[model samples]
Target chain A: MIKQILNDIDQNQAEIIAGLRKLIEMESSDGKATKAQEFVLKELKEMGFMTECFREDERSSSQVDYSPNRF
Target chain B: MNEVHLKWIIPPTDFEYHPEAYNVAGTIKGKGTVPSLMLFSHIDTEAENYFGKFENPYQSTIHDGKIIGLGASDDKGGVAMMLYAVKTLLKYVPQLPYDLCVMSILGKHGGGFGTLSALMKGYTGENSIYLHPAETGHGFAEIKNISLGVVDLDISVKGKPGKLHDDLSEGVNAAVLISYLVTYLEKYNQQMRDKNRFDFGSFKGEPSFILNVGTIEAKGGYGGINQRAKCCVRIRFYKPLTIEGVVEDLSKYLKECCEKEGKVNFADVIIERGSFRATPAQVETEDPFVQLIEKKITDVTGIHQFIHQYHGGSDIRLPMLYGKSHCVGIGPACALPQQNSGQMEWISIDDYINGVKILASILFEYCNFDQK
Candidate 1:
């Protein structure tokens, strides 16, 4: 069973490579994880995962750009 | 999002909170209402503000096959890959019998208050995964279930004030008393280090407990003898050692010092602030979660990832204790250069991308999406 699975993974190595490059290319850090999170939500929803995203309450947030920026 | 800042205190007070703090979470739903798999990453950088207006901290660039930026390796790498894994799994196999939730939390670097808030919002599961900054060679490393305990202590010493011209011996100087107290406490910590019997190895080869005097303040500088001196102390200890027990012992020690040293009152050594504690946690590798995760890691990476204790504490500890969850920390093999130095940090681009593939494979198998 493991051998079959490994073979299947080998066949789709290109997709995994491309997918990783795309993820690493997106830049989100600091209090800006929400930016990257929004991007994740889009991909998940596009791929049919029931998804929800929340921004920190502005009244409590310490950073400037806490609002969701849709792409 | 501006520059990085480090809060000496674990969870800063509301007044100290940055204006840009926020949290984001999403779920890949399962067939039933059973608690889903959980993944968490902190959003904030350590202290980028110290760097001033330099190049964009959020701008990520791939150089020499590495992703360089401020939060790239520390946590965003974890966040990016965790989310990407979910996307990949769903892309190849959409239906899942179990749910998976990914959270990019704020304030983890500060004091984990953002993750605390997320917990309040009900972000948890029976088994969870955490994204740590360091790498374990096995493609995935099962974090040691145990983390060290921490306590934030605020101590003040009071003594009789006297003028600089007055006899130094006659004056019950609070500064002098506090200094004496610090010396004694440091020696006590050293003694404990030498005699620590518990072999948890949280410190690897060193003692488990550490006492750090983070800050100190006196009413007057060295010029005059002040009546009061205050200091903030942080204590790190392993399990079976509670903060309350340490504070009790500390009070007794202070009282003894006062009696032996001068006319200063023992009651004057007040514990003004306390109650900040992060307790230690441990999970056995034989648990179902561990077995499943280990198998998945081996299947994906073709390597047996070792399950061992982690050195640092994280937000997952809270949920592990309260929610009765199994949380494992794993991440890309990337070096976090000057993580809080306000300098550019880096994560291996290949490692980051490969991590996604491994995690995706694990998710695909663990969630049994293909079985459906």
Candidate 2:
């Protein structure tokens, strides 16, 4: 079953390459990752997965976040 | 004397190519050549937290017996010390048994780009040291080793979407699921600390190793249910727990939690890797070169110095990876300066001058100036 999944992805190599190029061209920086994320969400939706997006200010996820001061 | 130029592999959008960054190095020849000793310092500063935004990041001033500037402590101070030490030593000694080289490198902050380039160009040495700021018991300290490694990852979790009015059993909440993983990992890290697995040698601090979920975002309105969420995590770790090891544990944990019978349902979780394999580097405490450094610092400062592992990594780690010499870190700073925080950073003028003295003493002692 895993082999079949791998083979299917390999067969669609051209589509994968095109999608990667589109993402690279988008030039995501700062908080602009969301703009590129929309492209990913669109692809996921077309593949029949439901999706929703969020940003940093969304307080719902802050409680579970861990912030380290040092790099 | 040679100036090394590095052309950028990936140029910024506005320009075709940036001016070649350079590494400056000079060496003083010895009378009876045997092996060489090297001193290294970075020439670059963390210019901006985020680029394309305007801020007076470079303005500097002198205040309270200190030099205040952006890269004051981070490296420009060390650079000054290295050059002055060389000039004084050349004027006084004129000849030695082993050649002494002073190097100033670029790209120490971004990655070990300049150091790695110098290594590729064969600028390594037999015995080496680096100057970086660290808090010491006295006004100076040397690092036993630096064992901190880093990884940044982006993860997305997906589940079936359901209406808000529906019962909780109808769909999986990404927020809840991610929280579970976070809690588990936190406990795991604490357990590791308890077992002394996160040992920091002589360095003293709380949470010697850290795992941080820097940012997380989940979508869900009061009346609408969301099916996806994303998070970014950064982990700094010590030896025996590498980036790959952490990722492997995470993968195994996810499988055990979700794939078992009667578990919470999630269609898939994807992990996007960033800086996945930057490992830590260190030198043994008992090496002869290290012992000599300890003796020299003690003799010059007349204060007992401490040998400890640094919590952070630096370009000094690059030499150790090449296995050419025993690399150690020593610098003259009473306290570490603030970096990357748009604030005026400073290095003590006394400490800076003393640093030059300490380095000169070490170079003179290590090269056996008495014989000359």
Candidate 3:
């Protein structure tokens, strides 16, 4: 089992790099990880897992544009 | 939301938070034999604050066998690793005796918002792994089981509000008075560093607590001094020091210093605390699940070490705090592509592949009740 798991990861080098690439390009910052989270949920669904998303709380526009100066 | 997190520390919330955003999680059910295992990492990062530092922060590039991007080493690598580990695990150990949960929570930007929400929503496991790279820059060679606490506050000195046309030196400049306090605080910070030293694997007598003055400004914007001269303060501390204790202690020292110096009116000095107060959390290294991960790490990469973290403010704290789980953090060999070369951070493709192997091994054995 150990060998199989290791071999599986080893053989999927291109796919691993591609996976990291996708996440890096998604740009999930400022509490906006929706795109990246969707991608991850899709991957898990492919793996046959029961996936779901937790919605964030509503925030004000000023709160969204928050920076150190505002604090 | 802003009340619970900081502008920078619990932070990452420094940027305006997106409304109606979601934290995604995946779970696989299993027989009621062993406790479940969870894989968690934040998906959000600080905004493109490094705007001019790198060529393209968003683009992932490869150089000398390293994958580089804005958040690659910071945590995107860990997020990818968790995804692939689960993908491979389902193929190798499809018959897990216990459940498996994988989460991509919003990270520091929300000031631990996503993780705290998940924990409150009762989405946790008996054994959890926070998939974040060790800030020590040691990658998978290190694992963090400790969550360092932090205190975030602002300290400022008030001055006479200058007129729009007032010359630069008309009023007792708040900026000038604040400068003296800043110098004193720097010295005091050094002393605190000396007192909070730690000796971990390959971390020989290093200061575990780092007190950083993240930002300082006069709010005058190239004009004369404004009504207040302020700076943001963050202290990452170890156990036995509560946030209130640190705040009260530091406040007292600063007040005494101002009184003794009599440079500026003592009343003018203002120390306003923020809401981002985080407490430390830890799970014993001797816990079977942690040892199992350490063993699998050795089994896969022939490298092992108990790398306790000196700074903390991430998803690593949630499981131990809310789930009562044995948690340890492990990630790829993530670091900067070059040392101070104005380049994006990176993670070794080899180390990343090896990390996948390690996580897969840990998952298989930890959930494989057949072994017991």
Candidate with top TM-score is: 3
Q: TM-scores for all candidates?
A: 0.77, 0.68, 0.84
| Candidate 3: pairs in clash | A64-B16, A64-B17, A65-B16, B10-B111, B11-B108, B12-B109, B13-B109
Q: Give per-residue CA lDDT, model 1, range A1-71, as digits (tens).
A: 33443445556555644443444444433344444555656765676655544444422211211111210
lDDT of each residue in B4-93, candidate 2, tens digit only: 111112211221111333445555566655567877776555443443232444444557876655556656566656655554555455
Off by over 4 Å in 3: A27-31, A58-71, B1-13, B45-49, B53-58, B161-171, B197-206, B219-226, B336-340, B368-372
Candidate with the larger DockQ of 1 and 2: 1
lDDT of 3: 0.72
Off by over 4 Å in 1: A1-34, A49-71, B1-20, B32-35, B50-55, B109-112, B135-144, B164-170, B194-197, B200-206, B260-264, B274-276, B295-307, B337-343, B368-372
lDDT at B34, model 3:
86
Alpha-carbon error at A15 in model 2, in Å? 63
lDDT (10s digit) by residue, model 1, range B94-151: 6666777777666543234565556656777667877755533333554546655666
- Report how far off residue A52 is in candidate 3 (Å): 1.6
Better of 2 and 3 by TM-score: 3
Q: Looking at model 1, how many pairs of residues clash?
A: 18
Can you write out model 3's per-residue Cα lDDT over B1-372, one digit (the tens) per residue? Answer: 122221233322344557756778888888859888788887876566644565666788889998878778767788888888888888866778888888888775333456667776777888889887776677776768776777678878877854444555556778888887887688778887898765543345877677788888886766656677888788777666666567667766776777788876767776665546566667666667777888888898788555655446545666766666677888877765344365567888898888788888887887653322
CAPRI tier for the interface of model 1: incorrect
